[model samples]
Target chain A: MSENLPFLVIAAPLFGALVASLVGWARPRYCYAIAMVSLAAGLTAAIALLVKVSGTVSGYEYRLGGWPPPIGIQHWVDPLSALILVVITAVAFLAVMSARANLQLELPGKERFVYPLMLLMVTGLSGMTLTGDAFNLYVLLEITSLSSYALVAIGRGRAAASCLNYIIMGTIGASFYLLGVGYLYLKTGSLNMIDLRQIMIAGDMHGSQTVITGFILITVGFWIKMGLYPLHGWLPNAYSFAPHAASNLMAPLMTKVSVYVSLRMMLSVFTPDFLAVHALWAQTALLVATIAIIAGSLIAYSQTDVKKLLCYLVVAEVGYMAGGMWLMNRAGITGTIYHIAADAFMTCCLFLGASGLIASTGSRHIRSFRGATRRMPWTFAAFLVGGLSMIGVPPTCGFFSKWFLIQGAIEGGAWHFVAALIFSSLINALIFFRIIELAYFKDVEHEDDVSHPPQVQRNEAPWGIRIPLFITSVVIVLLGVFSPRVINWIERFVDSVGVT
Target chain B: MSDVLTFIISRFNYWIYIVLMMIGLYAMIAKRNYVKKFIGMSIFQTAIILFYVSTGVKSGATIPILEHGHDIGHAAAAINPDHYANPLPHVLMLTAIVVGVATLGVALAVVQKVHDQYETIEEPEILFKLGQE
Candidate 1:
């Protein structure tokens, strides 16, 4: 049973999707309950798997259908994958906790399809995290992308247009990934990641032009999927226009998982030795990451819509993780892995709270947050916690990730990356402070509030939204307090992978 | 010049696939019509499928299926190393084809919705209307 946890984590959602789509047509109301139950089951399996993996020097691999590697596909849940699997399921659960409210207001009668699509998307995401086969990863990536395309299309007012753009960009990205895998297959005749790694090392294929081209193609594919910098044209509109419930889950998981895939490609499939052989590639990637950070931060600073602002912030967070991963040092890998977990939760909490505020304030503009602290104090507080985390304040998970990232840059002598991190943090501080001021103060044009007694309205978001937001905020702080333990786990994984 | 001709002729499949891919990419990027863009996407995906399928081809290889059917030991002893073309790429591309179709379906549906809402499927027109709204 313990060995089967990897398959079970994915199976729970796949089974739920089947059941929901089947029964939901007749009884649409039960779809939400089914989705919740399945996600909860997945979360449970993921946590158990994490616990099991944490006790081991190396993690377990469950061969599918009792078949061996290079031929049979397997579920490889190393400590790294197990940790990320837990984050994916946990974030999905939290995001779905508030879906009941969001969907009722937004779609009204479309719970059945939405729930199943969300479940399938989760299935694909978790499957992508768990699979050891490169081809299997591509299939699962399509499953995720296809379902998300539909989910994004479910949004109101210009969503379909954005969803079309997303589909076009996403298809190109996924196709490039397939082409890369095909190139590798032509070279090695094996689709399994571990087998591919072994074969490449044995065959001395690192310097081979085909293998190098495959690596670059694969990296660019994931960069597009992850919306890194110039290739991120499809992201902001697609995410901001999607339904809140969908965006909350997609925004955090999609890019982070893509980052994880690239990292997995580097550590597991391609090896650090290969990365060293191509030092120029890593330097170029880091430079692009630096530009991504500066550009994403500046664009985020310019957004008037709160949702769009968060979306741009997500773009910048991807830069942070991408830069950290490319730093090619132990501290950098640790920071990247830790930031994966931290940013997922931070983005989840922020998006959840922002959706709640948008619902309550009846506007998407930043100015709609005026006097929000008096109206929905709990939601504002939760959002503020997320904002501070974004700014990398101490005692939040964000700060620890940034600390490791900067330490890595200093160690690697990449002063530009360190400067970019500091610059992005300062910009984040400015963005959040501006919002905080708007939320805490009355409008400046109507400055009669200083002399008169202000009436504080207690119009808070429902418990559905507040509870998840509160839970995520608490998790952010707890993760921060327990950073050393998480960092230890990450460092162990990095060391085991021979990154240093 | 003869050597370059031999090189191009020997890898003509790859060259054709690259050409098709570039054409598809151009249409996807430059075309204003949604349907044309999607057609380009299909062609782009088909080019990749062609590439993958082409990789499975061997000069004198037959189909991957064994002539001995169920006699594994006998077949293993009798079969030559290069007797069969690889079947995995075709199998993988079957999945890719299904994914391509599903993506096309979703893309078309979104285009229909866009047409319904804005009464146009042209990119610039949609942008102009969205800007107005």
Candidate 2:
């Protein structure tokens, strides 16, 4: 039963999707309940698997149909994957918890199909995290991308064009990944990650041109998926134009899950020793990552729309994680893994709160946040907490991850990354403070307010919106205080995978 | 000269795939029309499919189906590794092809919507309309 947890986590959502399609149109009310219950179950199973993996000596691996590697699809739940799986499930659950209210408002007639699309997306992400087969990963990635494309298009307005752009870039990304996977299969005659790793280790194929080409192709594919800088053109428009419910989920999990895939490629598919032989790529990647941080921040600073600003910040966050991964040390890997969860919860909390505010305020521009603290106090509080976390304040999850990321840069002697991280944090400070000023200061009744305080009404968003925002904000802070323990587990996993 | 010609001719599919891929990429990036871009996307995906299928061929091999009842072990015949073309790439390409079709369906649907809203699928005109907003 314990060994089956991985399959169960994915199966729950897949079943939910089936049920959703069957009953969603006729009994649309039940669709939300179904999605919530299924995602909750997936979250529980993921937590259980994480606990089981932590308690055991070795991580759990379930071989489908009792066949061995390269033939059977294997569910590999190492601590690293378990961590990411848990984050994805938890974020999916939180997004579902907050989706009901926003979905009704943002996508009025589309409620029937939303549940199944969201469920399918969750299942695809869970499958991507669990699968040990490279080809299986690609299949799951398409499942995720295809569902998201439909989900994005479900809304009115510019959503169709946004979804189309996402589909185009996403398909090309998936195609490149398939080509790379094909090349790897041709070189090694195995599609399973572990078997391919063993073959490379045995045959020392690291020096082979085919292997190198596969590496380059796969990295480019994932970078596109990761939305790292130049390849991030589709993200801002696509995510911001989608329904807030969709944006709330897509904003956090999409790139972070792709980062996990990239990590797997770097650590499991190609050993760290072999990566050193290709240091030039890592170095170039880090340089570009630094540029991404600065450029993303500068561009985000210029955005009038709150959602678009947050989208650009996500690109910068990707730069941070990618830079940490390229540092290629234990501290960096630990930071990168820890940041994956940290960033997800923080981003989810912020987006959930922002959507709530948008619903209440009836505007998308930053100017709409004027007096946000007055009308939506709890939602504003969630924003504030999540904002502080984004700014890397102490006792928030973001700070610890940034701390280790900076530590990694210092250790690796990469002053450029350190400078970029600090500069981006400063830019983050400016971005958040600007919102704060607008939300708090601009709404005050002029010079008379100093003498007489004006009453500000609290027309808070519903509990559905408030509860998830509260939970995610609490998660951000809790994960911060417990960062040491989290980092320990991640470090152990990193070492076990020979990342150091 | 004959050897060089043979070498080039043997891998003609790969060269064609490269050419098609380049054309598709250029269209996807530079074309102003959404329909043309979708065509480019289709061509891009097909080129990759072609590339994958071409990788599966062996010079003198038959299809990968097993010739049963003529067991090499029982007949004591020499078995060459390349006697059958690799089937894995073909199998994977089937999945890719399905994905391609699904993507195309969604792309066309979105294009329809785009056309309905703007009355044109040209990106520049769309951008002009968007700027008005």
Best-performing candidate as measured by lDDT? 1
- Local accuracy of candidate 2 as per-residue lDDT tens digits, A1-500: 87788889999999999998888769888899899889988999999999999887658788877888778889898988998999999999999888899987778767678889999999999999999999999999999998999888887788887777788799889878988887788789899999999999999899998898898899999999989999999999999999998989999999999999999998999989988887798889899999999999899999999899999999999999988999998888889999999999988988998898888877898888877777777789898899999899999999999999999999998899999999999999998999898887766345246565567677787788889999999999999998889988898788897766
DockQ of each: 0.94, 0.74
Stretches of candidate 2 off by over 4 Å are: A444-449, B1-7, B67-81
Which model scores highest in DockQ?
1
Q: Candidate 1 lDDT, tens digit per residue, A105-215?
A: 788989998999999999999999999999999999999999999999999997898998899999999999999998898899899999999999999999898998899
Chain B TM-scores per candidate, in order, are: 0.94, 0.83
Q: Once model 1 is optimally superposed onto the true structure by TM-score, how far is the C-alpha of residue A209 displaced, in angstroms?
A: 0.3
lDDT of 2 by residue, B10-58 (tens): 8798789989999999989899999899889989999999998898898
- Backbone clash numbers for all candidates listed: 0, 0
Clashing pairs in 1: none
What lDDT tens digits, residue by residue, belong to model 1 across residues B25-116? Answer: 99999999999999999999999999999988899999998766686865576777588888888998899999999989889999999999
